[model samples]
Structure formats: C-alpha cells, structure tokens
Target chain A: DTAVSQTPKYLVTQMGNDKSIKCEQNLGHDTMYWYKQDSKKFLKIMFSYNNKELIINETVPNRFSPKSPDKAHLNLHINSLELGDSAVYFCASSQGGQGGYTFGSGTRLTVV
Target chain B: EDKVVQSPLSLVVHEGDTVTLNCSYEVTNFRSLLWYKQEKKAPTFLFMLTSSGIEKKSGRLSSILDKKELSSILNITATQTGDSAIYLCAVINDYKLSFGAGTTVTVRA
Candidate 1:
C-alpha cells in the first residue's frame, strides 16, 4: 500500500482560479508536510502540521493555505492561482523526532 | 533565516565511477541532516545523519555528516545508470526541514 497518497496527479487551470490538493498518509505518523518544487527543482517547505496542529508556516503568500483535518490528512488550498503557482507539490509524513519522511507521488499544478 | 546549500548543482559520470555530493547548512537549533534520491516522482529516503563524524551506508550509497563544518557529503560508489537521479539534502531544525537546491546526477553507461 502507498504510505502517502496525493490526489489530482495533474492539474491545469486558468489564472485566478482556486484549487485544492488533498493528501493522506496511512503511516500512522504524527507529522505531515507540504513542499513545493519549482521548475528549477528547488524543493521548499510550505507548511508543516503535527497531529493536526500547525507547526511551521513558511513565508508563503496568504493565497496558499494548508488545512490538516487530522493526523492522517492534510490538504492545500490555493486561491487566485498565478503563473508562479505552477509547480509540483509533494506531501510527506514522518513520526515526531524522526529524520526520514515518506513522500507521495506529488501533484503537478499548472496555471495557464 | 535557515539556509541549506548544495554544491555542484549537476554532475555527469560514467558507470562504475564514484561521485560525491556536498551539502552545507546554517540554522539555529540544528538537529539532523537527511539525504534523499529522487528519480521521477517522489524522493526516497537514503540516509539520516544526526551526530557528526558518523557515516551512514546503504548498498553502494553512503553519507557522512560534519557538525563542525555544518556540512554533509553523500558518496556513491561504483555507480550504475540506475543511480542517476536528483540527490536532495535536507537539514532539520526543531522538527522543520530546510532543503537545499539538490544535485542532479546522471550516470551514463
């Protein structure tokens, strides 16, 4: 079974449209994260949630919001997507105090 | 701001060659460093180094961390074409990870 799974493997939308990406983990992990990978392949952490509590929030714009319904689910909602929002978004999960993380296949978002 | 930097953004090597990838970081409340190999979709965890001067190994891949230098190195020995992928380095600080730009390695047979 896939430890971490993300929906909408590919998404293409017009500018200013809003969208949401869902992530689920069955690893029984307490910590989950959302990362963005740009065209240059630079991975940057956008948000982190531990047991449904917001732990880390990077300097991302307010347009992007992360909601963790529970320890097993974390979803990202982007408002008014722009060209810069085109990138690959990956979801990951790990136990607290652990170093290794299990990642999902990633969702590719394209804003045209 | 916490920062992680990786050297040699990209490298090309022939099969059976050995290659080393470097990662350095600057952050407060440092905890550990991790190495991951990304082939196409998701990145697979390779090693995690918490203490300095200790090396972690798996198959032909190995990595070591140096706290004094705030750096780490991942070495691949006798690389095969299958080893070609983007190597990502991440530093953990207070449970949050700051990732480097990553090194792209292409092993040609």
Candidate 2:
C-alpha cells in the first residue's frame, strides 16, 4: 500500500478553470502539507495542516485553497487557475513538526 | 525568510563513480535537515539529519550534517545508472519545511 497517494497524477486544463487534487496518507501521520515544484525544480511549501487545522500558509494566492478533511487526508483546490500554476503539486505527511516527510506521487498540472 | 541552498545545480557522472551533493540553510527554529531522491514522480525520503557529525547511511547513499556550518551533504558511492535523479534538500523549522533548488544527478552507463 502507498504511504502517501494523490489522485489525477496528470491534469491539463485551460486557464480560468477550477480543479481539485485529492491526497490521502495511510501512514497515520498528524501533519500534512502541499508543495509546488516549478520548472526550475524549486520545491516550495504552499500550505501545511496539522490534525485538520491550518498551521502554515505561505504567500500563495488566495485562489489556491487547502482542505484537510481529517488527519489522514488533505486536498488542494485551485480556482481560476493561471498559466503560472503549471507545475507539479506534491502531497506530503509527517508525524508532527519533526523528521523527514513521506511524499506522494506528484500531480502534474498543466494550464493552457 | 528561510532559505535552503543546494550547490552545483546539476552534475553528470559515470557509473561506478562517486557523487557528492551539498546543501546549506538559514532558518529560524531549525529542527532537522532532510534529503530526498526524486526520479520520475515522487520524492522518496533518503535521510534525515538531526544531530551533527553523525553519518546516516543506506546502501550506497550516505549523508552528514554540520550544524556549525549550517550545511549538510549527501554522498553516493559506487553509483549506478539507477542513481540518476534530482536530489532535494529541505530544512524543517517550526511547522514549516523549506526546500532548496534540487541538484540533478545524471549517472551515465
């Protein structure tokens, strides 16, 4: 079984559209995070949720929202997507605020 | 702002060779440093360094952190073609994890 998994591994959509990516972790972690990797392969943290509560929110646009239904699930929803949103979105989970994270297979979003 | 810097953006090496990747960070409330290997899809955890001078090794990959220098290094010995991937370095502070621009390693057969 996958420790962390995200659905729709590849998503291609037109600009101004709305989409959502789902993530689930079977590792029984208490914290979940969403990261974006641009073409430069620079991974940046977007949002973090601990026990279904939002903890850290970077300077990401308000159009991007993260929802943690529970400790084991965190989903990302993007509204009115832009071209700059074309990148790989990764879902990760950890026990708490320490240690290495377990990442899921990224969802490649291509905005046309 | 928290910063994690990875050196030599990319490298090309031959099979049976050794490769070293460097990472340095400046962050508040530093908790630990982590290394991940990204191939085609996800980034798989390789090592997590919390204490300085203690080497963590797994198979052909090893890593060490130097808190005095605020840096860490990942070393791959006897690297094979399968060792090719983007190596990511991240620093954890508080509830945040800041990442460095990954180092791409290409092992030629």
Candidate 3:
C-alpha cells in the first residue's frame, strides 16, 4: 500500500486560477507536513499539522492555505495562483519523536 | 533560524567506488538528523540519527552523527548505478524539519 499519496500528480493551470492538491496518509502517523520544492530542488516546509491542528506555518504567501480535515488527511488550497507558485509540492507524514517522514510522490504545479 | 548545509552539490563516480556525503546544521533545540535518498519523485528515508558517535548501517549504506560538531556523514560503499540519486539531509527542530539543498550522486557503470 502506498503510505503517503497526493492527488493530481501533475497540474497545469493558468495564472490567477485556483487549484487544490489533496493528500492522504495511511501510515497511522500523528504529524503531517506540506513542502514546496523549487527548480533548484530545495525543499522548504510550508505548513505542518499535528493531529489535525495547525502547528507551524512558514512565511508563505497568504494565497496558500492548508486544510486538515482529520489526522489522516491534509490538503493544500491555492487561491489566485501566480507564476511564482510553479513548483513541486510534496506531502509527508511522520510519527511523533525520532522517526523519519514518508513523503508522497508529489504534485508538480505549473502556472502559465 | 535553523539551517542544514550539504557539501559537494553534485558527485560523479564509477561503480564499486565509495562516496561520503556530508551534512552540517545549525539550529536551536536540536532533535534529530535524517538522511533520505530521492531517485525521481518522493524521497525515501534511509537513516535517522539522534545521538552522537553512534553509527547506523544498512547493507552498503552507513551514517554517523557528531552532535558536538553538529554534522553527520553518509557513506555508501561498493556503489552501483542504481545507487545514483539525490541525497538529502534534514534536521528536526521542534516539529519542523529544515532540509539541505541535497547532493546529487551519479554512479557510472
């Protein structure tokens, strides 16, 4: 079974269009995270949710919002997407304390 | 601010050669260090080191952490073409993990 999965492995949209990426994890983990990887392949944390509660929110633009309905799901919603938002977004999950994360395949978003 | 830095942004080596990837960090409230191997898509976890001077090994891959120096090294011996991938190092502080830019490794057969 896939531990962490994200929907729409690839997304191509026009600028100013809104899109959402859904993520789910079956690893029975407590903490989940959303990360953005740019063209340079530098992975930066965007948001973190623990047990469906927001724990960390990086200085990402206000257009990006993360919604965690439950502990097993964390979804990212982007409003008024801009060209700079073109990047690969990854979702990952991990248990509390001393464990590495399991990352989703990732969603490659391209805004034209 | 927490930061993780990796050395030798890219490496190329012949098969059967050994390579060492270095990772160093500076962060407050340090928790653990993790190594990941990313082939194309998602990164796969390789090892997690929380203590100093203890070596973690798996087959041809081994890693050790030095908390005093705030650094860690990942060693891959008898590397094969299949071992080619981007190695990423991450440091956990509180609940967030700060990731390095990653080191790309290419093994030629």
The TM-score leader among the candidates is 3
What lDDT does model 2 reach?
A: 0.94
* Poorest 10 consecutive residues by lDDT, candidate 2 chain B: B37-46
- Cα deviation of B78 in candidate 2 (Å)? 1.3
Off by over 4 Å in 3: none
| C-alpha local distance difference test of each model | 0.93, 0.94, 0.95
Best by DockQ: 2
CAPRI category for model 1 = medium
Q: Candidate 1 on A1-112: residue-level lDDT in tens?
A: 9899999999999999999999999989999999999999999999999989998888899999999999999999999999999999999988993676889999999999
Better of 2 and 3 by DockQ: 2
**iRMS value of model 3?**
1.3
Residue-wise C-alpha lDDT for candidate 2, range B1-109, written one tens digit per residue:
8889998799999999999999999999999999998999888889899999999999999999999999999999999999999999999999877899999999999
The candidate that achieves the highest lDDT relative to the unseen native structure: 3
RMSD vs true structure, all candidates: 1.0, 0.9, 0.9
Clashes of each: 0, 0, 0
Across B1-109, the per-residue lDDT of candidate 1 in tens digits comes to 8899998999999999999999999999998899999999998989989999988989999999999999999999999999999999998887677789999999999
What does DockQ give for each predicted structure? Answer: 0.75, 0.89, 0.78
